[model samples]
Target: MAHLSSRRRHSRSPLKAFAAVAVVCAVAAGGAYAAGVGPFDRGSDAPAPAAADQARAFLADWSGGHYDRAAARTTNPSRARDVLRSFTAGLDIGKPRLTAAAAERTAGDRVRVAFTAKMPVTGLGTWVYKSHVPLQEQANGSWKVDWSLGLVHPHLSEKEKFRLERQDTAVPQVEDRNGKALTGKAYPSLQPLLAQFTDGGGRPRGSILLVDRVTGETKRTETTFGRQAGKGGEAGDAPVKTTLDAAWQSAADRALESGADGRNASLVALRVDNGEILAMANTPATGFNRAVSGTYAPGSTWKIVTSSALLLKNAVTPDTVVDCPKHLIVGKEFHNVETSEFRGATFQKDFTESCNTAFISLRGKLGGSELGDVARTYFGVGQEWHIGIPSYDGSVPRPADETEKAASMIGQGRIQANPLIMASVTATAASGRFHQPTIVLGSKDGTSTTPLPAAVVGRLRTMMRATVTGGTAHVLADLPGEIGAKTGTAEVAEGEENNGWLVAQRGNVAVACVVEQGVTGGGSAGPILHNLLSSVPGDPS
Candidate 1:
C-alpha cells in the first residue's frame, strides 16, 4: 500500500536469504545426528561395540532367511553362505524367527552374541534353540563373525552341516543255518518276538549268541541293525547273521499259531551234536521270549534227568520192574493222570508211558542231592548262561521233605524249565554228553559233568525211542527218520489247567514245545514237536 515497493522488496531479500540459509544448516545438522555420523558418532573406530553391532546384525539377517547377507558378516563368507543355504534346505522346519538376540563384550576386542530361534517342526510343533556367535574386530576397524559348523548346532562338527534325518537305520535281519534270512521277512507271529530284541530306536543288533558247531567259535559282531538317527560323522549299521534254520523257524511258527487256541505256546530246537539253535518260536509273537525265559514246572519231561540220576546211582535199570498205582500218599496225596494202574511194569515201559506214579514211588531211593546234582551238573539246569541275550537257564532245587521229593521225581516240586532247557535235555540224551546250548557264536561253553556212561545212555535212548513207537508219543511213530519222544502234562495247581509239554529228537535235531493250559502233552504239544522235527532235513540213510 506504500509508494516505495521496489526498494522495500530488494532490502527484505538479504534478511529472507539469511533465514533460509540458517534453516538449511539446521536441517542438515539434525539429519547428521540421526544417522550417527556427526555429534552422536558410532564410528568404525569403536572396536568392541562395533563387533557387537555386527553380531546382532548378522543374527537378525540369519533368522530372517537373508542367508547371503548374514554370511557376508563372517570371516569365511563363501563357506558360511553355502553352509547356511544347505542347512536351511535340509531342515524339516519352517523359517526360523528370532526370539531373542543380545550382544555382550568379551576379552580383546571380541563380542559374543547369544540368540534364540523359534522354528516350527513339520509335525512336532515348535522347537526353540539357543546358540552363541563370536565376533571379533578386525585391524581395519571392521567387525566379522567367526564361521563354524557349531554355530548352527552344538553337536555339529567341522566340515559338517545340519540335516534332519531319521533316528535309526533298518533293523538287522535274522539269518538261518544256510545263510538264509529267517527274520525281517513277513512272518506275523515272529514280528512281536523279534521286537523284543530291538531297542527304542527300532534298531536290531547282530545275533552275537550264534556259534559254529565244529569250530566252537562264536558269531560275535559290533554291527547293529535297526532304525537310528545318523550322527554327524558316523556310518549306518551292517547286516547280522543268526543260527536259526529259516525253514524250521517258519514251520515252528506255523505250528504254534495254528494250535495255540488263544493260549500261550512256545517252542525251541537245537542241534544235538553241537548246541546251535535251529529254531525258536512263540505264539502271540510278543516281546516276551517265553521259549527261553519262561519258568514253569517241567512235569514228566524232567523225568529224563531223574531217570539219569537213578541209572547213575544203580537204583533201577530200564528192565527193572516197578509198581504203578492209581494214587499214592507221601506228605500229600498224589494221583496219576490216568485212572488205570499197572501193578508191575518195567521201568522202560513206565518211562515210555510217562507214568508219574512209577517215578514218584521211587522218590525214597534218591539221595538228598542226587536228582538236583544230575540236573545241575549233567543237564545244565538252573545255571546262569551268557547267550548274548537275557535268558533264564533253568532251576532244580533239592526237595526238603518226602512229599516234595515225590513231586520232584515227577518234575513238579521246585523244578522249573523253559522250552530251551527241555530241548537241551533231549539233545544231551541224544548226544550222550551235556553241551550248553548257544545262540551266539563263540560264547563261553557252560560247565558240564563227566561224560555219561555209554551203556546207560544206550538204554535211555532205546526207552525214548519206544515212546514214539508204542507209548504216549505214538502219534509221531509214522514220522520220517529215527524218532524218539516224551510227553508231559504238568499240573500247575490241583484244580487249575495243566501245561502240556513234549520233547523229541530226530537225527541231529532235538525240539521241545509247551502249551499253557492245554488238554494233555501228547494231545496238544506232541503234534507241534512233530511238525517242527518233520520239517528238518534229516541225514541220508
Candidate 2:
C-alpha cells in the first residue's frame, strides 16, 4: 500500500495561475527583449520529420517534480487510479490550448508525433503561451502522450505532500561558506518561537516552514515547543545549503526585534551571480518572511527601472544635467524630492541623491508602456518570482498621463514592490545580467535566464554604487567593505512613515531590507546591514 501522510489535502484553486502570471510578467518585462532568435512563434513553416522525433526525445527527458517517481511511474496493475491521479494532479495544469500540430514516422514503422500545447495560465499571453510536448510510438505503432506534461497538478499524493518525513520532499539546505552548519539543530533555537507565531487575535498564523535554498527542499517538521529547551526541536535531517550567513541571520533578528519600534522589518540578501538568497529576516512576527511576502511602495527603487528606460532609448546619459529645483510641473502635476536641494542636477547626481524631480523631468523621454516594459524586464516589478516563501506582485503604475510618469519616476504614483523583488533588481546589476532570484535555491525546476544587456546592467551598477559611496546611502561608506546600496522613504496615512528600504550587495552577498513605517531607510536600515555584515564569518575582508 502507498503510505499517505495525514496532512495530505487537495484544493481546487488554480495552481498554474500563479505560474502564468509569472511567465507573462517575465515576457512583458523583457519587452522586445530580443529573443536571440525569435518568439516561439507557432506560425513557423511545417516542422520536419526529424522535429517530431526530437519532440519524443524531449518528453523522455523530463523528471517528475510533484509526484513520487516510484508511485507516479509505477507499472503496477493495482495502482492505475493512484498513478493517474498522481500524474494528473502533479501537472498542476489549468486550461491548456494547442499551439502547433505535427507528426512523423520513424524506422521500424513506429509513428512519432510532436505538438505544442500551452498552459494559458502561465502568462505567456495567448501568443507565446504554448509548451512543446512530444509523443512516442507504442509497440502497436500508435502515438502515446508522455506523462511529464502531467507535472502541473495542483495537489500531490500523500507521499508527495510537503513534510519532513515525506521521502519526496526536496527543499534546499542553508550553511555558511566556511562549511559550518547554520541550520538544522546547531542554531534552530528559534523553532519554538516560530511555533508560537500568531496574529493579534491569538490565532495561529501558520506553521514555520524552513526552506533549503540549494536543493529547493522544504523541511516542514513542527516548530520547537518552548523557549530555552535543552535540545532544539526536530530541525530535520534534510539540510538546505543557503548563501545566507548564520551570524547575519542572528544579528538581523536582534536588530529587527529591538529597532522596529512596534512595526515590522523584513530583510533579504542574495548572491549576484546565481540569484542565491543569502540572508533573510522577518522580525517582530517571525512567521512572516516579508522579504518575499511584504508588498509596499518602492519609493526611489523604481528609479532603477526608469533609468533602464532612458538608457535603452539612449535619450539620456549619466552626465545629462537638469534642474530639480523643488518640483517640476508636468501637465498640472508636480514632482519633487523630500529634500529641496536638487534644483539643478545631472542624471548621475540625481540618481545618487534619488531626486524625484530630476527623474520625473525625463518622463517625456520614454512612454508609459516602454517604462513598464523596462521595469518588468530589468527590475522584475509586476512579476511573480518563485522564492521559497510567498511574494507579492509589484505594480508598475501604468501611467495615464505624462504627470503620472513623473510620479512613477519618483517611485510614487501606483508603484509598489516587495523587498524580494528589489533585491533582485540590485542583484541583476551586480551580476552583470538579469537572472531569476529565488529564496529557495536549486529549485526543483531550477531558474530561467534572460539576457539583460551587460551595458544596461553596468550603467545601473555605476549609479547604484554612487548612492552608497556618496549619495543617499553614504552612511554605508563606513562599512568594512565596499558596498552598493540605495534607500527609499515613502509617506503613508496618518503621518506614518510607510516604507523604508535599503537594497545592498557586499562582495558575494546582496541584500534588501524594508522597515515598515520607519522614518528613514538610511538611518535604521544602514546599521542593520552593518551588524549583519559584521557578524558574517568573512567580514571586513
Candidate 3:
C-alpha cells in the first residue's frame, strides 16, 4: 500500500502538473546560486564522526537558511547534493527563509529529522506544517530520505506494541448448611447449569419454592447469575433462595444418586401443615421427569383415595372389617398383588398393607362413580393445573364393568398419578384439610379452604401410621419422626415390570419417592425416603 505522501499523488491532477514544475525550477535556481556563494566556507571542516550525525547536521543547516553550508558538511558531497535537490523540488522558495528544526539518531544507521516550514503571504495567515524526514546514510557517507515522514516517526517516543487472553469466571454455587458447595462437590451433573450461568454472562435467573410447615406457606426466592442480579426484581434477575433446607436438599440429591447403574429416580418433599415442597428433584439421566410428571397406575396409593371415598360416604369406617383373600374374583378375572389377602382386617388395616382384594370388594359394594367423585373432587385428577411445576393430571377410571371397577379400586385400570400429586394427597391426610400446593409465597387474599371433616384426616393418619409400623411400609418404622407412610408397586402393561413409589410424612415434612420398573415400593423407593429423611434435622416432630 502507498504511504501518506503517495495520497497526494491523487490530489496532484494533470492540470496542476506544470504549476508544480515551475515552482520546483524557481527554488532550484535560487538554491544553486546560494551554493555558488559558499555559505559554509570552513576549509578545516573535517568529516562528521558518523554518517547519522552528518545527516542530522545537514537537516539543521538547511532549516537555518544555510543550504550550501549544510551541503558542504556532508561526508559524501554527491548524496548531499541530491538531498538539496529533493528539498527544493517541491517548493517555490526564492531564497526561502528557514524556520525551526530538531534531529535525533536511532539504534539503526538511520537519522530522524523534523522541521517547521512556513511561507509568508500578505493576505493569508502564516501556513505552518511539520515534516519528518527519514534519512538513510549511503556507502558514500551521505544521506537520502528512506521513504516518507508518514512511514517513520516525528517524535522519538511515539512507538507501541498490542495482544488478546481467555480467563474463566467462577461458577454459580449451591451450598449446604455449613456453607459447603453441594453441587460441585457431590452433584457434578449440576455443573452444566452452573457453567451456563457463567457462560451466559450473568443473565441466568430462576426461582425455587420450598415448604413452610409453621404458617402454611410455600416460600419463594429468586435466583440470579451474579451477586447483584441475585437480589431479584421485576426482570426476575435475582439469586433464588428456596425453602429447601440446603442440607436436606443435599441429602435428596445424594440419595437420587444411588443405583448408579442408570436406573432413573425422582423425589418430592413437602410440608404437611400446608402443602409446600421442601425439595423436588429428579435424576434426568434420561431427561424424563418421573417424579412430578410420571402418570401411571398409582397402584396401592390409590387405595388411600378409595378409602377416603368410603369414609366420606359413611360406607366404611376405620374400624369396618373386611377380608383380603389372595384373589378377588371380579367378574371372571382374578385381581391380586404379592399379599393381596389380609384375611380379616379392618378398613385401616387393609389400607396399611395395601390389599387389592379388600379394596376391590369395597368398590363393588360402594359402586364406581362414588369413588370417582371423591378422587376427582377431593384429589386432583383429570385436571390441568399448576403445583410449582407442571404435572400429569392424575386420573380415575370410569369403569364399565365389575372387573374394571375392581382394578380401579386398587389404583389400576385407568387411574394415574405422578409422585408429586400423590404427595399432595398424602399431605391432605396429614393436615385434615386440603390446601393448594404453592411454589411461591402469597396470601390467600380471597381464597378459602375446603372444609374436610377432622374425622377423615384423623382416620387416614392412623392407616398411614399402621403401614409404616406393621405393614408393607415397615421399612420406614424407625424413621426419625412420627412417620406415616404408604407403598405402591404397580404392574405396567405388556410386562410384569412395575413402577414403585413410597410416600410419607413426619410431623411437617412429607415426601414421595418413585423408582421406575422396580421390585416394589417398599424396597427401592422406601430406602430412598429413609436416606433423605436421615439427612433432615430435629426428628420432624
Candidate 4:
C-alpha cells in the first residue's frame, strides 16, 4: 500500500509535486532557523535578497571607511582594498555618508547602483559627488560588487584615484608699491609663494569652491594658491601689497630674459635710501631663485669693498698715483684683463678701468681683517637678512694668504655674492649708508654699519661716475639717468668662460645683474643694465 501511495504521489501533476517540495523546504528552513543555521545565518549559501540590498550594504561599509569589510563584498577584494587606501591617504574630508541610492536592473543577474555621497570639506563647507556601483550575481549565487575606479568616483578611470584634498584658498592679488597687480598670468615668477601650495607642475592640490558670504550660491572656484591664505591661499583674500615696482619689474624681466642669450642670469634692484626692493627677475623662470640665493665670485666687484677699506684707512686718495702693471706676483701670479695695464695712473683711474693688478697691489696697505670688516660694516656682506623670502648673505672671509687676499681684493677666491648683495653694495655707495634690501614691506631690519665718511663716499661716487664716463661701463654713460656703475668678469675656471656682473645706480634705484658663462661684464651684462635703467620712467638725471 505504501509503495502504491509513493507511486501515486510521484505520478501526480507538476503543481502537486511542486507543492510537496515547498512544504518540505519550509519545514527544513524552520528547523534550520531554530538552530540558527538558516539561509540568513552567517556564511549561508543563499543569495542576497536583491542586488540593490547587497550594493547598499557594501556602500555603507565603504562610506564608513570600513574598507576591509567593503572590499570583501567586491569581486576584487585585495585590489579594491589597496586602491581604496591609496585614494583616502592624506584625504581630509569629513566622515562620508550616503545621502541617497537608486538601483536599476541592467542585463541578466546584474544591477546598476547610483548613489550620492556627502562629506564636509575644510574651509569649503560641504561637498557632494555621485558614484556608480555595478553588482553581479556570482557563481555561488551571491551578489558581489564589481570593483572599479568609477565606484570611487564616476569621473575616475581605471588608472585614476579619488581624493578629498584641502583646496587652496584664492590667492590674493599681489600688488606693487603703487597698487598695480603683479599678475601671475602675465609673469609666472611673480607668484613667489605659489610653489608652497601647488604640485610640481604648478597645479593646485585643492581648489576653493568659494561661496558668496551673503548668498548660499557658489561664487567661483579658484585653482590658484595665493595670499588668500596668508599669500599662499586661494583667490579671495586681500591683495598682498609688495614693495616691488611693476614697471621696473617688467623692465627687469624683459632685460634678463633677452640679455641672457641662453645663459642663466638674474637681476635685483633696490631703493638706495631705504633698501626697498624695486624689482627681482630671473631668466628661464626656474624654481631656484638665483637672484637672492646664488653664490658666486663677484670678480672685480669685490674691488668696491677693497676700495672702501683703503679709503677708510686713508691709504690712498682718488688723485693718489698708483702703479698698474700687466702682472703682479703675490703668493700666486695676478694679471690684468687682456694684459692691458695702465702705468702710473691715479687710484681713481685704476678703479674706473678695473685694473685688477693695480687693486691687488694695494693689499699690502690693508690689515688682515680690514677687507672683511669693511665688507660686513659698509656693504652688509655676510650679514643675515630677512627679505620675506629665501636669500643668501654674501661671505667675505678674512684672507688666509697673500694669494687669497689678492683674489679677495678682486672679488674672487673665497669671496661669494649674489645679485641682491651686489645691488645692496651699490645702494650703499649711492646713499652713503647701508640698509639691508627688502622685498616685502615691514620685514625685519638687519643691523647696519656706521655711516661712511663724507670724504670717502664722495671719492667713491666720483670713481663710480668715472666708470660710466670712461671706464668699463662706458656703454651706460649716455643713459638718461645720472648713473654710476661697476662691471665685473668673475673667473670661474682656468680656461672656461667667466661669469659677467654689473652693479649700477640710477637716480634712487640701485641694480645688479649676473650672467653665467659670460665673458665680459660690459659686453654681456652692460646692455641688460642699460635696458632696464632706460625703461625707468621720469628723468633720473
Candidate 5:
C-alpha cells in the first residue's frame, strides 16, 4: 500500500504528470533538494533567536484556521495558502490542536522542527499524527517554512483528499399521533412512504476516508465513528410523528381496498377545523402513496375553489340563473360529462351537476390570474408546505389562453391535484377557513387566506349539500349525517377513461377520494367515501 504514494506525484497521462510536477514544485519543495536540506550561509552569519519559534508561530496560526498568516511564514506563500486551505476544507475536520516538539538545528543555517497534530474527526475520537517542518532563513533575515502539500499530511500527494463517510446510517422511526410505533406491516398503505424513510436513514455510525482526488478511489479508512454499532442505533433520528388516526386509517385502508372495485384509487381524510390528516389510504396498499403524491386532473371537485373566487368577487349567487349548454367552445370544445346540458338552470343546479359548459361560460368574469391567485391565497395551492415529509403542493399554472382559463375554471387543462390537496380544499370550504393540511406533527401552516365571506360559504355549503341530496353525488346521501359533497369526472387523454373524484364533509371531517377509470366521481368515488366516513364516528366538533 506504501507504493500508492510517491515522492513525486504521477498522473495517468504525461501532460497531467508534467502539470502535477509543476504544482508540487510551486509549494517550495525545490528547496529540500531531495536531501531535506539546502545550501545556505551557516548560522554564524545569521542572527536567529530560535528557528523553532517560527515553526511554533506557523503551527499556532494554522491551528487557529489562520491559513493566510501561516502561509506568509512559508517559502511560497500563495501555493502554501492554497494547499493549507484545501487541506482543512477538503477534510471538513473540525479545529485541530497543534503542538511543536523538539527542534533540531542541522550542521548548516537550516533547522528542522517536528510537531504533533491532533485532529478531531466528526463522529470519531481524535486522530494524532507526527510530521516534520523544514525551516530556512530567507535572505531578508526571516525564518520561513519550505511549505509543501506533504507538510499537510506526511503521505499527502497531489490530487489526494480526505472525507468523512457514514459507516452505519440513521434509521427512521415513524410514530402515530400519540407516539406509538407505526410500521409498514400495520398500515400497508404506508409501504411506499416507509420506503422513503428507510432509504434515507439506514443504520447508525460513519468513517473518514483518505482518497485519490482525480479518481475518487478510497486509499484508506483514516478513522471510524465506531467499530460496532453503539447508542447511535438506539433512536436514530427523532421519531417522525404523524397526525394519522389508527382506527380511521384502518377503516380507510379497508374501504379503499373493498370499494375501489379492484381498480387504482386513493383517499384522504382531514379535520376541517385544524387540517390534521386523519387517514390516507390507497388501493393495492403496497405501491405508490397516491393519496398524498399522485397528481391528477381534479375534475369538478375543484368547483369548491372556483366557487370561492367567484363568491368573493360577488360574480354570482346560488340562485343566479345560468345556462348549461351541451358544449361550449373558446379555443376548443368543452362539455359536461356525457355532454349533459341543462337550460335555464340555477347556478346551484349547475354546480350540483358538475357542469363544465356552465363554468366555462363564466370565464370572462375574472382576470386571467384571479383564479390561480384565489387558489394560492385561499387554499394554499402552489405554496410551500412543510408537511413533515416530501409532498407535492398543488400547482395552478397561469392559463395561456381563454380556453385554458375556462378549462382551469372546471379543473382541467393542466390543473393537477392529489387526494391530500383536494381533501384540504374540501376541509377549507366546509369550515369556511383554510388550515394547511399536516400529516406530521409540528408542520408549518400555509399562508393565511382572507376569511371566506359567510354568505358565500353558506351558499357553497348549500350547493355541496344539494349535490349529496339530489344531484350527481347522491350516492352518499343515505349516510347517517349531514354529508355535503361535490363530484368530478375528469377527462384524460383522448382514449383513456375519465378519473372519478369526490370531496365530502361530514361533521368536522373532510374527505376526498379518487378512482381511476371509474367514469364518474359520484358513482365510483362516492360509495367508497361513504363506506369509509360511515365507519368512523362523526367528529363531535
Candidate 6:
C-alpha cells in the first residue's frame, strides 16, 4: 500500500495526455514535485489491454482530486468512493502524484496493473509506496477497475483502515538570519508569532505516524517539506529561517516591557531599505498579536499621508502659512490638543505641533476621495500583502460627511492602521518608496509604488526633523541621530480614553508602536520608540 501511494494517473480519458510520456518519464523524474506523468502502452498483446487503460485512467481521476470521477471508473462505485475518500482524507495525505507502470500481462484471461503513489502527508514527509489493481470486463463490453477495501490500501481490508495520529504537537525551532534558534522563553514577545513564523499557522507541527489498519500498528516517522534524514523517529523538518535580528528583538521587547507601563501596547521595527521585519513585540505577550493584526486610528501618524497629499497637489509648502485656531468648524467642531491655538503657523509648525484645526482648515484643498486614493496608490493601503502570514491590511475609505473628512485630516474617522502598517508607512516616507513588510524573506513579496516626489520627500523629512528637534517628539531629539517622527492621540469614544500612536524612521530602521488608552502618542508610545531607536547600532539595521 505504501509503494502504491507513489504513482497516480497524470493524464485523463482516451489517455491522449499519456500518449507520449510513460513509465519512463515517471522513473526518470524521481518524484520531486513531479506530477501529471502517465503511462502509454502502444499495441500491447495483453488479452485485456483496454482493462489496463481503464485502471490507468481511474488513477488519473483519483490523483487529480476528483474522487467521484475515479470511483465512476470502478465497478463498485459506492464502495470505491467511500474507501478512496477515507484513505486520502483520513491519512491527511494530500492529492498524491501517482506514477503508473505499463499494463501487467497475466498468462490467462485476466489483466492487472501496478502503480506508485508519492503521498504528501500533511505536516510530514511524503510516503512512497506501490499498489496494484485487477481489471474486470463488464457485460457492456467496457472495462472498469475492481474496487474493494484492499483497493484503497493493500493492507486495509473490510475490517481495517489507515489512521494518521498525532503524537507530538510541539513546533520545531525557528531560526534567525545566523541560524540561531529563537525561543519564546528567550524572547517572550515573539511567543505569539513563533508557530506562524514557519508557515503561517496551519496544522500542528509534530511527530505523526500512519497507523496500519489490520493490527492498529504504526510505521514511518516524519518532517514537513524538508527532506527526510536521520535514523528512526529522531528526524524532523529543518528549521525555517527568518530575517529577524535577535539583538534588536531583545531590545524591542525590553523597551515595551519597561515603557508600556503595563498598558496594552504593541511595537514593530523593520529595515527601512527592504521592509524586512526586525522585531515584533507586544506587552502582556501571548494573547493577541496586535503588533501586526490589530487595527486602530493612527491619529497624527496619518498626517504623514495627509502631508503627502497636500504637497503632491501643491496645496501647501513647508513655509505655507496656515491658520491654527483653538476652534475650527467645517461641519461639526474641531480643535487642537487642549484647544491651544497657534494663531498664525506655517505648515511645518502645524505638523510639528499636531494642530488638528490647522490641518482640518485645508480639507477644502483636497477632494473627499483624493486622500483615500493617494493612500491606496502610494501607501499600499487596502492592498493585499502576502507577508507569509495573515494580517489585516489597513483601510482608508473616503469620507461620508464633512465631519468625517475633518476628522480624517488628522488620522481619525474612517482611517485605520496597526503598528505593522504604520511601520511600513514610516519606511515609505523615509525612503520615498514602499516595500511590503515580510518576515520570511523567501515568501512571494514585492511592491511597485510611484515614488513620492523629491520635493515632497525633502519637505516632509525636514519637517519631521523639526518635529523631533523643537516640537511634539522632542523626547527623541535628546537621544541621538537625525530622526523624523509624528505623534497621535486617537479618539475612541466620547467617554473612553484614546489610543496613542507614533511612527518614525531613523537611519536604516523604521519603527512604530501604539499604547492603547495611553493619552498622547509622544508621551506614551514615544518612550518605547526612543528606547528602541537608541539601541540601533551605528551600522545598518
Task: Give me the runs in candidate 6 sitting further than 4 Å from their true place.
Answer: 1-169, 200-236, 539-541
Whole-model Cα lDDT of every candidate shown, in order:
0.64, 0.51, 0.54, 0.67, 0.70, 0.70
Per-residue alpha-carbon lDDT of candidate 6 for residues 192-282, written as tens digits (9 for 90 to 100): 5665554332323444444555676665443344322232222225676777888888888999999999888889888888888888898
Q: What's the lDDT for residue 344 in model 3?
A: 71
Worst 10 residues of 4 by lDDT: 23-32
TM-score of 2: 0.58
lDDT of 2 by residue, 266-364 (tens): 776666776765556665544334555444556676677678788878888888886665545675434333435565588888888877667776788
Model 5 spans with C-alpha error above 4 angstroms: 1-173, 195-239
User: Over the stretch 132-186, how does candidate 3's per-residue lDDT look in tens digits?
Assistant: 5556667776555464323211221113210001123345444332344446445
Work out how many backbone clashes candidate 3 has: 11
Can you rank all candidates by TM-score, best first? 6, 5, 4, 1, 2, 3
Model 3: ten consecutive residues of lowest lDDT: 1-10
Give the Cα RMSD of candidate 6: 17.9
Per-residue lDDT over 1-541 for candidate 1, one digit per residue giving the tens place of the 0 to 100 score? 0000111211110011111101010010011011111122244533355665566567656643567888899999999898777765555433344433445656667767676655433222234567778887788889889888777755455533343333332344555457765454456545654533333212232221223435644443212233233433222233334566677778788788777778888988888887777778877776556787666677788888888888888899988999877667775566666444678889998898777778888987888668878887777775656453445566555564676778788887656677888999998887788777776555566565666788768877898899989888887988887888888877654334667888988888888988877757888897777666666656311
Ranking by lDDT: 6, 5, 4, 1, 3, 2
Off by more than 4 A, model 1:
1-170, 195-236, 537-541
Mind sharing the TM-score for model 6?
0.64
Encode model 5's per-residue lDDT on 1-541: one tens digit a residue. Answer: 0000011221010011111001010011101111112233445644244576677668756754567888998989999888887776556544455656556776466877776776644323355688877888777778888887778778777777777675534446777666677777887787656533332222124576788988889999866644345543443357767787877788888888889999888899988988888888888775446677666778788888888888888899988988998777676566666657899998899898888778878888989879879988878876766555445566575665776778788887546678889998888788778888877777656466766778877988999999889898888878888889989877654444667898999988999998987877877898898889778866722
Q: Please identify which of the two predictions, 3 or 6, would achieve the higher TM-score against the true structure.
A: 6
Weakest ten-residue segment in model 6 by summed lDDT: 1-10
Per-residue C-alpha lDDT of model 4 across residues 314-345, encoded as one tens digit per residue: 99999999988877777656676676788889
lDDT of 6: 0.70
